[model samples]
Target: MGVHHHKIGGGKLLIAIVLNLILTVVQIVGGIISGSLALLSDALHNFSDVSALTISHVAHTLSSKKATVKETFGYKRAEIIAALFNASVLIAIGIYLIYESFVRFYDPQPVVSVWVVGLGMLGVIVNGGSIWLLEAEAKGNMNIRAAYLHLLGDTLTSVAVVAGGAAMYFWHIYWIDPLISIAIALYLIYASLSLVKESTGVLMEFVPEDLDVEEIAEAVAREPDIKNIHHLHIWRINDREVFLQAHLDFEQNLSLQEVTRRIEKIEKMLKHRFGISHAVLQPEFMRDDEKDLIKGES
Candidate 1:
């Protein structure tokens, strides 16, 4: 099967980017006119969404290109790279927002609540639509997940702005508007940093958190024709592919056909049981080599 099976393409992402661009501009104007920090922060989040979605769209398109000798993995990793960049950008923006919130608190101002509520409502609608478009693809792909989380978080932030603006309009609680912006910043920091760690793990070729090496060794050792499995390495090439390679010491000298058959059987078992998408085995009769489960990173 293809790497991008069931994944969305660039066209939907383009639409999302366009929607966010428009929302960002409108919210910025409204924020400036109303002197509302909440509106300005919402506009900032929308702008980040536009940047993230644009990166996601480019990566999504590149990932579909056919692999070649110069790029054997094709562009499958483009999504992971995009995700890392977007997440880092988000964290920086979050920190900046926090600093701005402090400044706003230090110098309080009267905000026009009507514009805050109105632009906030617009934020909800635009981000909601973007979320709808990208929701399905986010589960399996980290790149899209980063962008989706931006939309998801911003949608909630917009809701908070509307609530805070309502308080300011009716109860003279203008101080709460900066607090709303702070809340948005805190959430952005939390979500984006987590994604940054995940993307880093994938890029470092760390063993997937879900799979254990000893369990795999035990399963392979259980094979009647196999003596032991050693020097095992398991890592994900991207979000969707997990690759494993090991040296399998056989019980005795066996025919080439028999060895191939046993290898195929082990491959199938790994796929069915562990969701390992790719497996490579080196058959050995009595070769003197490392017997440890993990020698070092390959």
Candidate 2:
């Protein structure tokens, strides 16, 4: 399933890159000819998307490589790094746009062509198609979702640029160009901040947001032969791979095999309910109660 998903995602990203490259060329020419700052901003925005998509594609490919002796976790963190890099680029672009918009606001420029506005509308359509293509694979992956959000924002920005251009054509309100650029900058900032938060959570190895540690402990404690679960740890190695480690104390006379079965059941339950695919269970008999499962305690 992972392999299939990787292939599909890679293919979609390639298509997006090709489409965005074409749009970038068109927008750059149109922006120059039409004297529309919004169109130029949108073109720069697409350029950022191209860079982000390239990073995501390379990281996804690297992540599929087998683990080596030195890096036993393989290259799973590559995707997270890619996400961070993309978000940083987004922040930079947002700030740059904000500055340029301020300049354009002071001295508004003429917008020459409604035909270029039509082309901007076509860009919105293309960006929307890219968003839909990436949406399905975005559910289980943070990196892919970030990329998708970038594309989604670009699609909306394209729409605004087209609208602003049309307005300028009829009303000659050239300031709308700068206003639209400012709006795009604000949207990019919001989206990039969100991406940073999510990516940081994963990198810090925080537990999955949907999981409740207390509830998990209670579930294990409820087992017939189990007395307690302690030193429980739950964290994600990446977006889809969650890791869990805990000590399980069993009642007297519960055979090892019985205890194993109970723990396995819990593992299966965690996998099904919480999307945790990796788990490490350490079994302890009642006699070992005084032993600390978590090392380095005072």
Candidate 3:
């Protein structure tokens, strides 16, 4: 079932890539003819989407590979790395657009509204279609979400360019072109920064943002011998996998078999409650150690 789902996702991404490539070519030609900064910015945005989607498709493939002794974690983190790289490039593109928009704003060149409006409509349709294709996969997958957000931003900016183009056509408002480009640039930067931060967090092994240590402690307490759970650590292996480790202070020394049973229960609870795929728990009997739930930064 999982493999089938991944295959569907990869196929959809390829379709999106092709659509964006076509839109990029059309918009580049339209922007040149129209001398519209907004159309050009949208073209640049679509170009980034092509690159981002390609990276996501590759990473998605790598993440499906089986684990081995040489790489116990497999390639689960490939998606996160791809997301970080894609988002960083998006930000760079946004920054470039802002600079270009300002220069165009000051110069205030005449724009050909007919080409701008026609191709701007095409941009909206193409980007919107790609956004829909990736929407379901984006829900739980950060790498795919990065690509989806790019398409989302593209569709919105294309709408703005179309509106600006109409105004230019009806009222000869050339300044609206660069103004819309600036808005498009700002939106891309704003949308991409959060994705970049999230990808960075996973790669840095920061604690999973939504994890609750107290909930884990409660699970540990299910075993009567466990006095407390401390020295806790929780981090992500990927979007779908989390890892946890902690010390469980016992009321007294227990049999090895009994300890195994208790730990198994705790592991099950953690898995169901927090989606933790793996855990390491050390059992201790009044051992000398820092008994805090957390030691420091982990």
lDDT of 1 by residue, 114-143 (tens): 999998998999999989998888888898
lDDT of 3 by residue, 131-208 (tens): 889999999999999999889989998999999999999999898898998888888899999998889999998878
Pull out the clashing pairs in model 3: none
Q: Give one clash count per candidate, in the order shown.
A: 0, 0, 0
Worst 10 residues of 2 by lDDT: 288-297
Q: Relative to the true structure, how large is the alpha-carbon lDDT of every model?
A: 0.90, 0.84, 0.89
User: Largest TM-score belongs to which candidate?
Assistant: 1
Name the better of 2 and 3 by TM-score.
Answer: 3
**Residue 166 local lDDT, model 2:** 84
lDDT of 2 by residue, 75-147 (tens): 9988888888888788899899999999999999888849558778978988999898998887877778778
Candidate 1, 79: how far from true, in Å?
0.3
Relative to the true structure, candidate 2 reaches a TM of 0.90
Model 2 pairs in collision: none
